[model samples]
Target chain A: MKLSNLLSEKRPAILERWFDVVLETYPADTKNFLQKQNNQFANPVGHTIHQGMESILNGLLSGSDLQEFSTPLDNIIRIRAVQDIAASQAVAFILSLKKLIREELEKSQRMDSFIKELSLLEDKIDTLVLMSFDIYMQCREKIYDLKANETKRLTYRLLQRANLVCEVEEPGPQQND
Target chain B: MAKFSAKPKDLAKIRYTPPKTEWTETPVEFREHMFCHSAKPKDLETVGFPYGRAWSAKDDDWKLPDNWEQIILQGMKDLLGKYRSFQLFMDICVRCGACADKCHFFIGSGDPKNMPVLRAELLRSVYRGNFTLAGKILRKLAGARDLTVGVLKEWWYYFYQCTECRRCSVFCPYGIDTAEITMMGRELMNMIGLQLGWIGGPVAACYMKGNHLGLEPHTIKSSIEFFLDDIETLTGIKIEPSFNRKGAEILFVTPSGDLFANPGTYTAMGYLMLFHELGLDYTWSTYASEGGNFGFFTSNEMAKRLNSKIYAEAKRLGVKWILGGECGHMWRVLSQYMDTWNGPADFMEVPKSPITGTVFDNAKSMKMVHIAEFTADLIKHNKLKLDKSRNDHLNVTFHDSCNTSRGMGLLEEPRYIINNVCNHFHEMPENTIREKTFCCGSGTGLNASENMELRMRGGFPRANAVKYVHERYGVNLLANVCAIDRATLSASMDYWVPGVGVAGVHELVGNALIMKGEKERTQDMRLEPLPEKEGSENV
Candidate 1:
């Protein structure tokens, strides 16, 4: 059987295992809460991760283009980007899927027949890892930008109070020289 | 540069299981970006806080007073005796986990310790270990743990993680206010001079300078002058608001953040424009310049000390009653604690709206009225002309400031005004607003930049709700009454749901208010061109 058909067949199992791997990044107590409580507003981080993983899994199963994965990738990576984890660990969930897929394929005893397809699937995940890195960096950069802008916003009036900032004059039509 | 050497197999070897040890046995790791900086010794000394020595959360030696354990235990004992709510909360929790998923931090971070129940347990465990006889006998089986340095570290880490927004209390079957428990935890920490710089610095500044920004009297005046300049440029009307003037009809106090921060600065301009248009006889007091009391985050005594100025300033200025600006905790303090803390404002009369001639009998004792209530009355009486289309550019949604909604129940007034002013308005999910509002996640002085990650995590639920509205209704403006919401939610919206802006409700009101004798307006209070004039050169 083809790896794609096999993946489609094992989509639920793969997605569950992938989610467990992501949840493993949190503490045991947090992991349980994230897994059990499913309300979107009440458990947003968990809900976002679960939903994002499902979308990415659906995208992967259908062989969708990389661009189709941005929203899902962004939803999950944006969360991990601010979580208490290292950058490597933040994007590491994307790569862990490769090992899970390989194990599942090997368990099905189809590794030899689908080696080329497996290689292509792993390549797609590698591209996803890079995409996640970009999203992670974008979130982090936005945080830094927010921090700097907040300081500027907080001090904008203080600077004005000190006469350090002034409104720029709108340029008028120049008189003939 | 460090090379990316780990292979997929190696990375996959990362453990998926938590350690087998019990949660109580697990020590907290104070990771980078997880906590705020320690209070400076000078800031503590400024407010006469005990054990005013330099300390850092990262350092092994906290330089704590030698008898720190005794101080904390005794402080806990004293608090239990003094506040019935604290003691009742300590003893009453069944830990049904009703509040487990309610805290925004818990929802966002998924840290069990961030759960309101467990966060309270961090203290309740110590209460069991030290105070109860059955706990001493039963010990580990009774969920009791002594207040060791490790536990103290856990307490500091987890308690600071809570914004004390009280969403948990709404869900608790026994009405256990986790916020008061956190307040007690903070008070106990404060006894040993363990305080966050973001909070402690403001406490000292508010105590000394009458505002958290440490702006002197002249600087406060000069700040308002800048807002006046902006107001003039927007409306072609110069407003000359008085300060420290005797015999004014009312005294206005607002969070000093409005005087110094963006979005908040615009809110202050909104107040200036509104007051000017109403021709209100109000005087701003440099003595009681700030309505926000950062001291409330510290201890009951400090909160009273910081709050005493408003009534005192009102009396000194000989005003009839005090008018508070849009602030979260300020109203919480004013409506709940201020009357008991510093009342018999027998000297001041009950607040009556000058334009509408409406009596604020609810504020008879405190002699203070929220600006939302004041403005709602004005709108009810048709006292001010409004052009709702002036705010047509904004698809507005109101974020009920946690303190204002849960703390004082000042709910309908802001909405009534928003519905009157903005043409387009949407509500977030029913669960995320009103008395059950999620915090801006940076309230109670947790809005520091070093902990931006933590704030964003805590603010995720709020931003998530805003994102829902943004996607569904194209909500570009989040209108709120709290000054902290204005400042902190700005960063949160930028991080979580970019393109949605945070503004005070009155800022919307300022945009929509058609002030008498003003020139044809071309822009909103933030000086952005009005939607109709966006492409016109006349602007």
Candidate 2:
């Protein structure tokens, strides 16, 4: 059987393991709360991680295009980007999935073909990590943008009040003299 | 095992679980983005706060006065005696954990200390250790700890984390207002000159200049004049709003945020349009320009001092009653604390609507009416012609600003106003609205740029609810009745759920209000084109 088919069969277990790996990055109290809370609105960070991980697992197992993983990666990374974590740790969850998949697959019958397919799957995980990095940067950039925009928004009318900002006139049709 | 390796097993060994020490024993590591900068000495001096010195949260030494611990303990002792609620809150918490999960900060960041119960325990433990005999005899066993610099740092870190939105107090069976505890906590900290710059700066500004932004009298006029320009462009009716004019029937006071900020400025325009349409006799006061009191975040006396401006301005202007604009904590202070602090507003009448003759008997003591209550009364009386379809572009969801909802019991007025103004309005999830509403998470001077990460975490639950409505109902706009909500929720929306904009409740009213003999408006107050006019030549 192909590694993808094997991954598809073990999707639920792999997703859970991946989520556990991600949750481990948080403090002990946070991990406990994230694991215990089931309400999505009440535990949004946990919900976002769970939902994002599920979508990411599906995208990986289905051999979807790497670009298709943007939304799921964004769902998770957007949170981590603003969380009190290092940038490396923010995207480290993507790499942890490679180990999680490997550990999950090790329980199955390991044929010669599995090794070759495993390397290819690992390569895709690597690419996903790269994509997660881009998503992380985008989320960070968006935060900075929001910060700058807040100041601008706060001072916008004040600037106009100060005669510092003015509306430019729209270009009128040239008169044929 | 090697920390970094090409092999997956070796790499996966780098787990990031926290240390296994108990919470009280664990020292706080003041990381960047987790805390705000300390208050500058100048701001402290401006308010005559004692022990004012240059300090940073990142520093090893906070440069405290030698008797800082004594000051805190004495301050706590005075507060315990002065405020019965403070002492009761200190003693009466059963730790039922009803409030543990209610904090938006806890739900978002998963910090155990962010839990309202635990956050309060940080102070209660000290009270136990120092104030009670049981705490002195059996310290650790009684859950009491000595007031070390470490504990003080912990207090500063956790207290500021609280927005004082009081979602926790709602769930507490004993009705322990943790917000007051936080206020007490902040008040004690201010005794040591440990106020946050965001809170202190604004408190000082509001103290000196009558507004948080410190816009001078002429600047306030010009700022409103800028809004007048937009209102004229939109409705083609030039609104000449009075400033500091005596003998006006209503003295209008709003958060200076409305006069300075984006969506808030739009809301300011709404108030102008609404007042102009009704031809109400209202005057904006430069002296009482700020409705939202940052002084409330500092100390009770400071809050009282700042709040005195409104009644003073109203008296000076000789207004019949005060009509407050759409703001969150301002209404909380107005409805809850204003009369107690600066009351017997006997000079002003019982806020009877000049247009509809509807008496707001609820505000008879305070003699101030919320714009929502005023607008709801207007709509109920059918006093104003509203073209609700004008707001068709916005699939609106009302975010009950924490202060307005939980603090002031102003649950219905904003909703009534929204239903009357907009074509499409959807309520967020039941738990996330009304009395149980989550904060914008940037309240009580926590809305600083340095603490964006903290704000984002604190805002996650609110934004999560907004995301639900945004995805399900295609809700594009978050309508709130708070200026802070208008400012902070915009950042939260942009971060968590992009494409959904935040607006003041009055901004929607400005959009839907049809003025007499006004030219056809192609745009809303934000100068964005109206729904029907979108992509049309009229835009």
Give the candidate number with the greatest lDDT. 1
Residues B418-450 of candidate 1: C-alpha lDDT, one tens digit per residue: 999887899999899998999988988788998
Lowest lDDT block of 10, candidate 2 chain B:
B530-539
Q: What is the interface RMSD of each candidate, in Å?
A: 3.6, 4.7
- C-alpha positional error of residue B468 in candidate 2 after TM-score superposition, expressed in Å: 1.3
Backbone clashes, each candidate: 0, 0
Model 1: per-residue lDDT, tens digit, A1-177?
677898899889999999999988777778888899877877788888999999998898789999999999999989888776667888888898999999998898889999998888889999999999999889988878988999999998788778888989999999998
What is the alpha-carbon lDDT of model 1 when measured against the actual structure? 0.89
Which pairs, if any, clash in model 2?
Answer: none
Compared with the true structure, model 1 gives a TM-score of 0.96
Instruction: DockQ for every model, please.
Output: 0.54, 0.49
Q: Summarize candidate 2's per-residue lDDT along B1-539 as a digit string, tens digits.
A: 01123465655564566567788988887866677988888988998888788899888899988999999999999999998999999999989988988999998877788999999999999999999999999999999999999999999999999999999989999999999999999999999999899988998898899999888898888878878888888988988888899999999998998888888888888999999989989899989989999988999899999999899989988999999898889988889899989988998888899888899899989999998999998998888888887888889999998888887889998899888888789999998999999999999999998888788889999999999999999999999999899989999998999999999988888888889989988887878776563332101
Task: Show model 2 residue runs off by greater than 4 Å.
Answer: A175-177, B1-14, B533-539
- The CAPRI category of model 2 is acceptable
